[model samples]
Target: MLTNQAIRNVANDLDRRWISDDYFDLIVWYETEVQIHGFQLCYDKPGRERALTWTRERGFLHTAVDSGESKPTANRTPIVVADGTFPAGQVRREFIARSGLLPAEIRELVLARIKDYEDRQSA
Candidate 1:
């Protein structure tokens, strides 16, 4: 769990980020009162990295990471680009399985968000 003070000092908002060796990064934002505002899950870091971003205003967006290596720019920064497909089943299974180390406060919220995204997609 991230401290509220740290989040405020770094972002001027309530945000938490979890980085793991499990090849996924989870970033979450909260509105005042600790209500979840949004979250972005970046997965498969070693191979074909992708991001699943969900926001209260924009809903869900799945994107592939453009590693900025194709053009050979001086500054190699990864950017999110539009992705044609989201392997929902694979991502869901992998996330759930690997998220065991997450803190209890955030684990369930992220899992629920994943489920919500899949539900919306199937609907």
Candidate 2:
């Protein structure tokens, strides 16, 4: 299952930044050992719109973006660039909508995580 710890690890380790969110999922830009790019976590099951070959059916499907920018630069028009997935739980879309993870909801979690990471860096 997609534990909260996993998300925190991504935030702390990957330098995560929340850019956009919608009814389906949210997009995040993160840095890895090699490059910086964006990926998405679809709360619901994979859609038929794109040729998404999910890395996991029961977890969040993490797909690569063409560029580091989100599609449409506002909302997601998910285009399958690569196949990946996170072991996050398949929570309902409504739950995520009110989960304070999105920009419209609350930024406390994001800010706190960023602060924690920065503090660790300076320590």
**Could you say which candidate leads in lDDT?**
1
Spell out the clash pairs found in candidate 1.
Answer: none
Estimate, for each residue in 1-123, the C-alpha lDDT of model 2 and write its tens digit.
222222344434555433432323343444554343433434443432211111122322334434333555665453556544322323333334445544432234323333443444457
C-alpha lDDT score of every prediction, in listed order = 0.75, 0.37
lDDT score for residue 123 of model 1: 90
**TM-scores of the models, in the order given:** 0.76, 0.22
Model 2 bad stretches (over 4 Å): 1-12, 19-22, 32-35, 41-123
- Model 2 CA lDDT for position 76: 42
For model 1 the TM-score comes to 0.76
Over 1-123, each residue of candidate 1 has an lDDT whose tens digit, in order, gives 222122333647565554455577777777754677888888888998999988889988999988888664566888999996677778778877876766676778777777887787789
Candidate 1: segments with Cα more than 4 A from true spot: 1-14, 71-73
Best by TM-score: 1
